[model samples]
Target: MSSSTPADAGSKPAGPLSGILVVSIDQAVAGPLCAMRLADAGARVIKIEAEDGDRARDYDKAMGSTSAAFGWLNRGKESVVLNLKDPGDLALVKAMLARADVFVQNLAPGASDRLGLGAAQLTKEFPRLVVVDIMGYGRETSYASKRAYDMLVQSESGICAVTGTPEVPSKVGISIADIGTGTNAYAAVLEALFERERTGRGQALEVAMFDCMAEWMSLPLLHFDYMGVETARFGLSHASVYPYRPYHCADGDIVVSIQSTAEWVRFCTTVLRSPEFAKDPRFIDNWARVQNRDALDEAIHAVFTPHSCAEMIERLEAGQIAWARVSTLHDLSVHPALRRIPVEMPGGEMAEMPRPAGRIVASGAKVPPLGADTARIRAEFAGAAPAAAKQA
Candidate 1:
């Protein structure tokens, strides 16, 4: 939002999704993120929220005005307040959906069907609407109705089993479950849109957080199933690969990954200052090093502890070692590789944020204030004269 990041570079890209209308009854991360990406790709997203607004609006004040999470996922969208329990307000949402090209929601299990808004109902009624439904678990799962948060899903999907130290398993720092489900739902919507173009009909799609996380655990699952290897937690180190952990230096920390025999040889010779280690029987190959990982780590640690982070980085660069400096959020904020987009906050305050992933070029990503478009939406959907509010 700051002048540091330029806005109004040009008209927003005419992305492949142009002319699409996405109407979502959503909250929290999953549904919002799905719709957010649609908006980023040029679809006009109309967000429906409770009269009290999305509880995520108050998740935190990290963004100065609105919740950092809310602002990040709700950009480039219109906000409309609708009390689903009220007949009149519910009618408004139904009216909008009738004209929508896509409909996405993430309510509790069976809740959509109870409200007459489930994908089955919507897709059948509106043959051209691509309906997306996200859930905590797959529809047939026993615990489909059990509430699921990010940490809960991570724990259930085996992410926690491999995430932390051997002393105790820990959940991932980020909400991979919700994000993964959201991303999957977004992709499904795009696929459905394409299929609809050819078949002249839309389809209903489902994405479950548990299912998404389970797919992400494919590597470990394969090892456990076929190889009978239940990989243990290695903390910051690779469970199966030796010498992959971070080494503390005189100033900071750096992690080096010796993925190949040549890299391991070069690391031992140039960085560890011990050419003999490259040929030592105890550490000759990846298997040998992994077998004696403790010894290998101790040897590397002994060499690295005496040098400064900068000195180690310089040597690693010269030696062609694969390495990375451990970075904090402070480092990431202004990192050379980070790209930021200017955003208008809920209250018209300007702030800058990391741009969403992908190569799609677009602009005019605005963070809407809660229910900012409710009156305008009512006027437009009720077939009245359009209000001054900007559509989408």
Candidate 2:
């Protein structure tokens, strides 16, 4: 393992994405995330925005003024506010696309085509330009034009159906749908780029949040299809295991899972101090224990009531039982393995944000301010830019 920290490591002379130039007509999470990942790996990203800017800028009041999401994902890119409806700005965007290795967009449904930026148009004009489109739903579907948000997509894709307690299905607290789409788009774009090198032709990539969420919901979807029954939510409890849920240890609750019969036997003997309980016919196997869950829970609760959380954890650890504290969001921030990067915002203030995981990089650069490079880009590409292509 390389002992070099990404923070202390100097910029590499050769980056994995060094020669790439990406143009993005994007706003919000999915598009920004894709562009940011490219930029982080040393691609020169031009984030084309509407005059009003990405709505994510005003998402929250935390961190003084800048939204945390924007700060996290918009770094290391040149932002340019453009009016796509205006011929001049549209022409400028096309000029960038002419020279770009990649062009990505997540505009409102049909808006990209209206502005002549859809995959069909770009693929025709720039044969070798990788075009990636991010949408709420796939274009082939009837509901393609509906306004789609992360929470709505999660609900629509049936992710909420299997998550949370049985009484109330809840959307994931984070923007999981958007992130999923972004991640899928990123991987798809990389794959297309690789294939492009071989074929000498770039391909178009499309990813929708609904489609991504549906793919993620496959496990539950398959289970329901096979069994012809919906899985009931157990509120953090295992559906087929007893004494495999959170239990109060004197004051606070701790989660533990006793999966195998041998682990259950050890828990009964070492933790519960009732070795005979393991051999009780009613609680012998997982199925039987699950059937008698009420009684099993009561027995385990009684054993836990007398012990402190630390004592219970120590005993559980010694018994080789899997256990963990019910961690809150705050606990996640201070987790032992958590990595943070200091973000320097436009206002010259720095804040530590969680670093992106699984990012392979050989170079680094800072983000440009909104429209910081608009003049330079316009001047550089003005003469070479094709006239505004008529919309179909």
Candidate 3:
């Protein structure tokens, strides 16, 4: 892997992807997140934005100067403003892609093809360049032209059908559709990179938000299709599992899980202190317990309602039962297990955020401001010879 400029030598943090160049024409959560993960792995990512900049930058001013979404997802990348509609700007992007190891874009449907920046064209022009197109749906599907947002995709994919209370369906509180698609896009890029190493060729790839969410809905879909069973919505509880819901203690609520008969027996004897109840015909097996959940809950509440959460937790630990507190946002803020890393906001303010799993990023990586590197990047790539393509 190599970069277009020697400036990559000491500027990027040392990591597995050091010296690899990524050119991204991206905006919003899914696209920006995929580019950010590449940057995190030591790729030199140049984010090309429109004149007004990524819409997410204007979503909110929660970071004092930048939007919280933009601040969190655009760290350690260069920003270049470009109007792809302009021939010169479009040529400049092509020049950058010529030297880039990867090209990622999440433009609206047909927009990339119109600009001649679509995956097929790019892969044909630069055979060694891995191109990724992120979209709302697969281009072959009828919904390809339909607009997709996090909440809309969630509702369309039936994710809301299995969430929230029985009386109402609800989309997830967070942007799960976007987050999952971003992570999947990142994984797909990594896989493409690995394949390039073996095949000596690069390929075009597509990751659709609807496709990701539909795959996540597999279990529910399977149940409905094969068993003639509709998975019911159980707020804060497991839909198919018995004794896997939270119970109110005297002070707070704690969730308990019993996945096996042994655990159920132990829970009855040690946690509930009622060994005979474990033998009751109404709650002998998981299916039976699930059917008699109301009565089971009544029995469990009889013992837990008079005890504090700490008291019940102690019994749970003694019985080796899996349990967790129903923690609120405040509880999470002060959580003991949460690991944080320091990052510089676009305005130069230092902020601490939760660390991503399975990666160790050095502190103080700065999120780029809009068009922060436009002048420098233009001077570097304008009329400059393309870097030699990598060989397999």
CA-only RMSD, every prediction: 5.6, 5.1, 1.8
lDDT (CA) per prediction = 0.82, 0.79, 0.89
lDDT for 143 in candidate 3 is 92
Q: Which residue pairs collide, candidate 3?
A: none
**Per-residue lDDT of 136 in model 1:** 91
Native-to-model Cα distance after best TM-score fit, residue 351 in candidate 3, in Å: 0.9
Local distance difference test, candidate 1: 0.82
Q: Could you tell me which 10 consecutive residues in candidate 3 have the lowest summed lDDT?
A: 383-392
**Descending-lDDT candidate ranking:** 3, 1, 2
lDDT tens per residue, model 3, 32-140: 9999998888888999999999999989988887988998899989999999999999888877887888899998898999999888878877888889999999999
Among these predicted structures, which one has the highest lDDT?
3
lDDT of 2 by residue, 1-392 (tens): 00111221244333477668788988889999998887777667788877667888778746555677787788877777788889988878877777787888898899888877889988988888889989999899998999898999999998787778989888887999999899888888888878977987887888999999999887768868997656667778876567789998897998989889899999998988899999999899997997798899899899898889998998998899999887889999889978777666655567777778876433234444667667766676676635224211
Q: What overall lDDT, based on C-alpha atoms, would model 2 receive against the true structure?
A: 0.79
Q: Give candidate 3 regions above 4 Å deviation.
A: 4-9, 386-392
TM-score for each prediction? Answer: 0.91, 0.87, 0.96
Q: Write the per-residue lDDT of candidate 1 for residues 1-392, one digit (tens) a residue.
A: 00110122245455667778888888889999999898888777789998788778989988878998998888888888888888878777777776778889988778889888988877777777788998898888798889888889999999999989989999988899999999999999989988987987888898999999999999889989998989789888988777788998988889989899889888877888899999999998887887798888888888888989989998999889888877899989879999988888898777787877775435557888888888877876785222112111
The Cα RMSD in angstroms, rounded to one decimal, for candidate 1 relative to the true structure is 5.6
Flag regions of model 1 displaced more than 4 Å: 1-13, 279-281, 360-363, 383-392
